[model samples]
Target: MDTLITLIRWSIATYCLYFLLNNYISYFYGISLNDYYQWFMLPSKQAEIEKLPLIFSMILFLLSVVFLNLLLSSIQLKAFGNFETYIYLGNSSLYDAHYIKDGDSKVIVSQTATITYNSSFKNIGLTQNFVSNSSVTDGLGKPQSAISMGNLFASLVITFFFFIPMLGPVHALLSPMLAETYTAKGLNVFKYQWNDSFNALLALKGFSLAKWALSWVAILVLMIYCTFRFPLQQFGKRAMNLPSYIAANQLIEAVPVSIKPIYIERARKPGETQYFKRIETSRRNVTFRFDKDFAQSVYVTAIVDTENNNLIEDKITSHINSHGKMQLKITDDLGIQLVKY
Candidate 1:
């Protein structure tokens, strides 16, 4: 319990430091505070989603700063050859009787772990034991670097957040939880002095939770803003509108002629008055007879409907042969009949 608290406190403090520098201090660098507030605290405005380019750029800059900090700190730790170790017990040992002992012959009635190491050198499969003492002295430094890197990564993660939108907050909350679990388990295995202090620091978990909550609120505001301020007219005109030139001439040149009424010959089974139209059998090949008296080309479309009167197929398309008249072939199930649009 104490270890859990310590990890939470450490994670929260680290997160707070990053948040302050990125949001509070970095505001002087041309990014508007209002926009930041909207991004974090307000709902999205559709009309303003396009304006996100600026905010995205700012997030990228911050994430870069974080990455640099994490890189430098990671290099520093690696140079010192510090690493963390853990213990795993055999099935029998984990479940069997155990004893706790201190220096000399002092025994305690509490759960404790026995620690050992693999042989440094083996002779013909024979072994010896030696302990490794390398430890990560700067615990705070590693997490500080991570927080810095995450600040920048969070920017690139913004758009993708819509998919697994809760990842950021989930990550923030889990940092301390994971740390606490590992630290507590480590204490049972080895006499790592720092574990006590580390667990102590993690006790204050409230702040980390607060940071997650705040970030979530900010995202909600940005989404609301995007919805309200969307530029619909510009998109409709450019992407959705039919060309004026095509509409004026295309509709008139195409008209149906010599319409034939098709009939259902017989039902496939008793009480099945209508056959179900299938996608493959609907359109039999069309036969065309051309009239040289008509100078304009006719674009023909075939629409087939099911016995339930539902539109099974309606395709507006044309194919021109060497003779210059348009032809269209449609195929579907027997239950389908033609309709004119």
Candidate 2:
């Protein structure tokens, strides 16, 4: 229980440090604070979150500075490193943090993660979710649209290129703070100690939770500002005006006169073993339409849904031949369907 509390405190503190800095200078830089903590916003304003007022923003910044200073001075930074090791979230990628103890079975194993999110469930099968609703449409496993899937892939790229690239320096800067924290706690510097300061750990844990809660409130205010002040006009002009633009502009031309070589893919949710299969058949719909601007080329999309898996994927190369040919490649083993996507 103490280890869990420690991990939560460390994660909250790190997230806050990232969130606070992003929210603070964003006002002066004319950048949106929503970019970092948009997930902290209300559901309606998530995509359109905005800026913060200078006065309120300054207050939050000062508070974060004070809290961070206290945490660093108290050796909470080392506590954080120990907490990371405790939770198995450690890595040499961030810092060369080596905490070694002999003859201990428990060891921190560092691993990374990939985040995937689907915004809508447009083509998802009805059976995917136990109960379907208006907001999410279908269930958790529902496949994503091409554009939404693009966003998911974009997020992965950002995690690697943006976060990974910056974390090294950030980790290095924060590492020195551990010395002050150690001195305050009067701990052995040469040999690390643990499980001795219950009261101090509890106090830091409470404060970290409080700090995290207030950060969410600030995020909510910024989101409201963003939603109302969003530059929708410019986005609509460049990205596409949706149903409105469809009515105003010429209709999509050179639509697929005919489609051939109908291909179907089906599968059940994966089981403990790869060979496991369900008795029921699976259904899928592959759809296509010419691009709004380009008449000759149409974008192809496939909605893959089942009791076990839901996914939206596209072909790497989608060029209908000059002779109006639809080339769909399939395999005998239905599991091949899972591999293609």
Candidate 3:
């Protein structure tokens, strides 16, 4: 039973770790593991998936560190146990001190004699002051015992599944908007006092610096692994079996024309562009009518037939003299054509 419970715990932790890693890679690297693998399989898209600029990548790395710090700090705060409770015993003047004779020492006898104290004084004022001072000291001094095992486990589960995996990226993206909102509501986010206040709160919550450092190391290691592992794997595969990869792409392109999917698009507006999907057909002329307006000029962006295959222009420009009626003549043999007026 214990082994089964331990296995279940490890399984949940592993799953949460994978979930967080996947989200981190997807957000920072612009692709997930599965998507990266699929793209690697397709040789055509290899050049299209460009690496991010160095400066932008550095900025993302810093942002991820900030987000991870915030997440771990919040979890630590929530998992920390409450401070020792202090009961008010009225004023110091209410209780009278009576000295009780021991063999060699004298002890104060009072209604609260059972209560522990640093000294022989029975004054509630001194006790209150001591408790207040010790509370602050203990808050930062002892963090390991400040958190219970059960609460830490629960907090970890919530942090991994919900906070880090789901809301981490969203918060990072919307942080600027949130700051503006706070500023509009009279809370200036750029102020240094807010930083001090946050530090004080962390101290009060018994945040462990050691644990935070360890978390940073772990996150950095994981980031490095996720960033390079797939790219290196792809490079190795291409270098090793280049012919097989090329053959796979060629095989995909050699699919039968009759079974190939056909896509047809029609213009909703007078000067809208139209795309004619590639197909194998006999040479024939096809006519189309623009019911809305007449086109003065027809700009063919691309035309691909059995003989002539060329992209006329890089971009399509709508014709200005589109008025009463328009007619279009397109050869049916043009396998792929893009027309605009």
Candidate 4:
């Protein structure tokens, strides 16, 4: 039994080490079969067999945990005991003073004595001696083989019945995003020459270099697809529909303000110059924008009617001037703009 247990423990450890190495080496360039299948194939596959890698990975992880627990239990049994239990006493006086006399005490015989230092101390003068046993017991009541096998079978059943059903959404809904992100990052690594020494760090033998590179690409692709389906596609749709939601929230009586005399001219630099004549009006509220990019500062001034003449004051705030793209909204007393820089 001990020999068999040692073998199982060694096997489980070996399996875990290899699993870790495979996962690590496979993702060195940030991609894999799991990623490719998840991003490209899993979303399209209507069959379970096509989605086996993810499901198998989950099952293997679960089995590893169970095997680890068995291995730990065996080690604990060797150090401590096979089965262990302790009778907890309500009071220490009853357990320590009279019930448990001294050395090699095995059992405690007591009628329950309450100990209270603040109020009163009641001693039932517990009649029998308390004893402690160090002998090991098989908590599972079976050989290590039987217990290990039983747990392995239970875990397998759980994987099929519970985990398999949830694998599809997890793969379809999550993997694409991660796949895309990793793939982009890996490609960017080559572009920016970031982590340039990554290849040199790994001493690739035979066909491993190509295999590793391909694996990383596969993983990245899967992550990209997952992200796209769950967040990116939805984000694009929501962003495109935001204008309608904003329009619906406004009052119908709100007057439409037009930006006048808009002219766009190219600048000497990359960005262009936008020229427009500001509409001088007596109203305190007004909005303005340029059809083309503005290379220099533009000004909007409010013309207020005074005693006899119009008093012109700069209505532009520092907030609107600091952006590359802006939509200014001037409400009676408030100035707001939708800006992108």
Question: Is candidate 3 or 4 superior in TM-score?
Answer: 4
Give the number of the best model, judged by lDDT. 4
Q: Which residue pairs collide in model 2, if any?
A: 50-226, 74-181, 75-181, 269-308
- Candidate 2 Cα outliers beyond 4 Å, as residue runs: 1-235, 238-341
Q: Which segments of model 3 are wrong by more than 4 Å?
A: 1-32, 37-47, 53-58, 81-341
lDDT of 3 at 258: 13
For model 1, residues 147-206, the per-residue Cα lDDT tens digits are: 223433443234323322323322232233334444666633112333333233333432
Q: Clashing pairs in model 3?
A: 294-325, 319-341
lDDT accuracy of residue 275 in candidate 2: 48
TM match of model 2 to true structure: 0.22
lDDT sort, best first:
4, 3, 2, 1
Report how far off residue 325 is in candidate 4 (Å).
Answer: 99
TM-score for each predicted model, relative to the true structure: 0.22, 0.22, 0.18, 0.21
Q: Which sections of candidate 4 miss by over 4 Å?
A: 1-50, 82-178, 186-341
lDDT of 4 by residue, 1-341 (tens): 65676577667655664455346535443445465456455544334333555566555556555545554544444444442222221122222211232232343433322221111111121122111114323111222322233443443343233222333333333343443564565633222221232332233223333454565465455545533432210000110111221222232111112222222343354453444434444333223322222221112222223223232212123323442333433333322332211
Q: Write down the TM-score for model 4.
A: 0.21
Q: Between prediction 1 and prediction 3, which has the larger lDDT?
A: 3
lDDT of 2 by residue, 46-119 (tens): 33322232234444444554444334322432223211111111112222111111223333221211111111
lDDT of each: 0.30, 0.31, 0.31, 0.33
